[model samples]
Target chain A: MGLIGGSYAKALRRLGVKKIIGVDTDGKVLRQAQEQAVIDEALCGAGPGLQAADVVICSVYPASTLDFVKSAVPFLKSDVLITDATGIKGSLPEDVQRLLTGRMEFIAGHPMAGRQGSGLGMSQAEIFDGANYIVVPAAFNSSGAIEWLSSFAGAIGCGQVVQVDAVEHDRIIAYTSNLPHALAVALINSASYNENTKYFIAGSFRDGTRVADINPYLWSDLFLANRENVLQELAAFSQQLERWREALTVADAQALQEMMREAAVKRKDLY
Target chain B: MGLIGGSYAKALRRLGVKKIIGVDTDGKVLRQAQEQAVIDEALCGAGPGLQAADVVICSVYPASTLDFVKSAVPFLKSDVLITDATGIKGSLPEDVQRLLTGRMEFIAGHPMAGRQGSGLGMSQAEIFDGANYIVVPAAFNSSGAIEWLSSFAGAIGCGQVVQVDAVEHDRIIAYTSNLPHALAVALINSASYNENTKYFIAGSFRDGTRVADINPYLWSDLFLANRENVLQELAAFSQQLERWREALTVADAQALQEMMREAAVKRKDLY
Candidate 1:
């Protein structure tokens, strides 16, 4: 059980989801989850237990998620619902729905809740509190399945349940999540790379660069999965930064102040 | 009095600096400072009473700071020490020290503490409790003046007292303060400017763009005053971001992950 899986298990338990069975490839992780009571039942792989499961949630790396779904399809019960907590949804949701069309339903969900730390030790049920939960439904998804997932998200303490198409979800996430993470990494790398430079940092720099402390393996997969949208956002951000750079070069005080004022006014509505 | 001036007055009072006389162009602000006990006395302009003060601290906008120093010089005592709490050095420190050398010392200081809100209503003495206080000494500053300013910074509840040359101070602050603000503003402007987009914001986006909600008039002056250094930082940040963008474009997952890992390791030392 990793951080996302363990956190989902804990949240499911809190919502009175009995008989929570966790399946992971690692035996040590299964044993740890069992000892911590994060799961009532732990399985090394998909087995007969999957036939009895009404709904299966896959929380894995972005690239591995589709493979996990494909492997579990053979063992899943007929008419079962399959969902995932993956950051980027390229065409996987539609592909999975096509693979299991008549037998089951597949919907993609992304919980905007996580810590910089990883593994089961860092997971907690309350991490989902006041966080957004986004559900992406393809054409094959039924209305009843979407309703059930939305209500389940509410039960698990998600402050908001947002429904959007997969393409729109990935596009918005490229700006809101991926862009910020990329900027933080770039900002951190842009520093002087000397120990003494750290002493000059203040709260703004610390807050601006917090996401630079990231899990590289997971983020690289997310970035590659949604390369086009992320690239578009990167281009937009660089263009805006260049505008400010030009303003500063010419000492265009009016242009600089106007940009700051507009940003200040727009940022107020975010909170 | 405004936010920074009122906060400094309150902090000085906490350190038992008796008879704090505040001078402001606005009479209403002066009356508010007097009513809130932020200052023992408040005056609308530089008066004859300034000749009796042992030290004078000017907390004003960057462009107006030099003019304020020039006006107060004629009424100051022979050995009075003058310091300013301005965001940018802007050659004003050297000019002021040159004008008053062998008569009074002008040490430029910048307290790295402020709130998003303005005016005396939002001022609090505890704002400086754990914040940094930078003392930028010019060529003409005496060792005794630097020593006194450092002790005074500690007395006023500053956690760290950093001493740096005026040029070095501006260069570092361009990275630590100005660049972050510029990035924040650019990020906010780069958004689609749609109200619906705000719903997708999470902790990272909020933290990365918090400084976007800044006072335009004040920040414009700071940016123009230190244009060269800020442009240099902007150029460096753009170059780093371009590197990441190129990595993402080629689907070079290994290169992207390596950069992220290096940033994560470097960010750990900031805390």
Candidate 2:
């Protein structure tokens, strides 16, 4: 459990969620959350407290998410709906829904919100304010469940609720999220920085590579899990980059300015 | 004159400079600056008003810096010291110094400060408060003159003042400013963003691509003027991006994680 888990607890609480049960392997963090009133019942793992949970929000690193759910399944109520805060859906929606198979409901969600810092210490409910919540629905999920999840997201401070299929979710995320991370990481790594590097730093370099200081463990999994889409976006980005290279190579001032203008328009409109 | 020119006027005013002579071909803008107290004197192109100046800070687009200096030469006092706020040094220092040839002092300074928005409306002295001011010195420059320019930058609210030659200045800026702008423009161009793009937008994408809303006229000149160094940095960045692409292609999670960790460390250290 990290920033996402702690944030979900806070946001859910704001939605008047009663008897918030926090589950984490780290008993120390769980105890701290309980003391801070982030959650009412802090569980070391899945316990009898989960039996009363109408909704199970599984927030973990992508790699550990499936295992956590499988272990908790026996303790969850049969009517409980499980929603995940995974960055990339990949096959999580399908695999988890298949495993549940009418035993419970699973609707995967990716809250398009985060900060540079990670861990529960950095978490806050306000990160979700004006953020988009992507609902990745499996075939097994009822429309009613999806509708309820959308409203749940809105109630928890999300501004937009978008329901996309797992494939579309992964594809969209690969472009908007993963590709930007890859670029940020690559851009930062490309620098041959000495102590003098900081003296030359400005807004462009600072903001452009801010995401390079990432949770390596989580992001690497996100990159690999959505490999196909990430690779495609990377290729597209490379081609666009090559256009800049070609223009600079020939010192084509007019062509360079035109390309930059188009990009400026796109960026302004998109953002 | 654009953001850099207006900002220099503002900063020099903050330093208690009694007279801020604003120069521009745009007569209306000059008059507006005078009216708004941004300038003590508004000179249309080169005027007799420039004869009383001790120092001239030439803040124009990189492409026009040389021409502006040439036109202003006759009007400027022979003992006057001149500096520029061009993002790229290129041959500006050498060319300007050679042209002046003891007629006036020429010291090039690139205050590594900017915003996404351009023009006089967005100019502020606070932009330089913690910004790096890179002094690009030519072979003919006096040690005392360089030292004074460093202090001048400090007086104008800039933080660190780094003295580097024209070649080194161009090289460092290619890495820091030009490369990041190239990545931002390329990243924005890579996306086929529809109206739905706004819904998917998050901090990482937003911040990373913020500079994509560039001043095409200014940045294209910066990129082309510093073409060789910019191209070199772009190649290095492409190679770094290729590493991410390769790790994803094979679905190598551990390799990806290691690369990301290295990037995270570098980013943390450099920033």
Which is the leading candidate under lDDT? 1
DockQ of 2: 0.77
- Cα lDDT for residue B177, candidate 1: 83
Question: Residue A175 in model 1: shift from native, Å?
Answer: 1.1
Instruction: Evaluate candidate 2 and give its CAPRI docking class based on DockQ.
Output: medium
TM-scores for chain B, in order?
0.95, 0.96
TM-score of every candidate = 0.94, 0.96
In candidate 2 the C-alpha lDDT for residue B186 amounts to: 85
Best by TM-score: 2
Per-residue CA lDDT of model 2 for B1-271, tens digit only, reads 4687898888878888898888899988888888889999888887788998999888888778788888888888988999888888877788887677445899888788898879888888888997998887788888878998999888888888998888888888888888889888888877555667777879889988899898888888788888899888988988887888788888888888887888788888874
Q: Name the fnat for model 2.
A: 0.84
For residues A191-258, what per-residue lDDT tens digits would candidate 2 score against the true structure? 55556778898999998889888887888878878999989998888888889888988889898999
Score residue A206 of candidate 1 by CA lDDT.
81
Among incorrect, acceptable, medium and high, the docking class of model 1 is medium
Model 1, residue B117: displacement in angstroms?
Answer: 3.4
